[model samples]
Target: GYIVTHVDRATKYLMAQKIESKTAEAFNKATLSMFMPLAPSKRLTLTLDNGKEFSLFNKIENRLKIDIYFADPYCSWQRGTNENTNGLIRRYFPKKTDFSTITDNELQKVVHKINSRPRKSLDYQTPKEAFSLENMSGALGT
Candidate 1:
């Protein structure tokens, strides 16, 4: 299985799901499933790595109506927040872990831990608190 991650840039809120494949179709379905609960206004821009799984960016943009951008090749710094969160995820899942072995509930538990943990950047506020719809709108100046 492939673990797909979508993070809120402002609050560090993370929405991660486990998918069976890393194909463009899987990424599209995972992304839509992860973001569709929020209003279209809340689902704004998405910055993704230049991975083949994201090759279907046009379809994603059309479905989500969100602007999409890609980081320059070899420039992980452009997506610092996502990279840092991936480090945190590694604490649980690790680099060599077989993602297929983990159940959905186990993945959700990890996500809950991440969201509940306080971040130094947010003045120690948990992402869950900072990610409130109202708070996110204000933080995003929406």
Candidate 2:
């Protein structure tokens, strides 16, 4: 499974999705699905690390019509937001744990817990509160 975060630059609202995949193809599909529900203006750009796992960026960009950028090798600071979130996730699933044992339902629960937790950057607002469908629609003037 992969964790994808979509940040709306204008409002600083973020939508995060946990996607389950068995292969690179499935990963790309899951990534696209996560972005499909958002407003076009909010889906401006995607920045990902140069991991082999993200080699399918072409598919994601083509399907979503969003630009994709890659961070330089060894430049983890460039993707600090995502790197920090990944660290938070590691608290739940450590690096050595076999992800193959995790079920889809269990994965959703993990995603739920992460989203519901308060974020200091968001002034103690949980991501669920800050980036709810209702809030996004309102922010977009929909």
Candidate 3:
């Protein structure tokens, strides 16, 4: 399985889904499903990897009513929030963890745990708290 991870820049909120494949179609479906419930806001934007699997990004932008940008090659730091959140995820499932063997419920538990913690970036508010308080803005200085 492949892991698709998303982190809210404003709140450090995390959402992840495991897919059977890493194709563009799989990525698109997982992305839409994870975000559909919140529908978050039009202010949402994504900083993503330069991967062919994200070829359907334009479709996601249209459905979610948001913008998307690709990080520069070899510059993982460009997506700092995402990188940090990935580290947090690593705390639970270290490098080379067999994602295919991990169940979705087990993964959601990690996501829930990460979002419930307080962060200094959000002034000590939990990511879940800050996410609800966002009012559809201010993730990337909006």
Report lDDT (CA) for all predictions.
0.87, 0.67, 0.84
- Give Cα distance to truth, residue 25, candidate 2, Å: 1.5
Clashing pairs in 2: none
Tally clashes: model 2. Answer: 0
Q: After superposition, how far is residue 101 of candidate 1 from its true place, in Å?
A: 0.4
TM-score of each: 0.94, 0.77, 0.89
Highest TM-score against the true fold, candidate: 1
| lDDT tens per residue, model 3, 66-140 | 788999999999998899888999999999998999999999999999999998888999998988777455343
Candidate 3 local lDDT, residue 83: 90
Give lDDT tens digits, candidate 2, residues 103-130. 7676667767877888777778776776
Q: State in Å the error of residue 88, model 3.
A: 0.8
Go through the candidates in order and give the C-alpha RMSD of each one to the true structure. 1.9, 3.9, 2.2
Global lDDT of model 3: 0.84
Residue-by-residue lDDT tens digits, candidate 1, 1-142: 9899988888899999999999999999998998778777777789999999999999988988888999999999999888988899999998999999999999999999999999998889998898895444553311
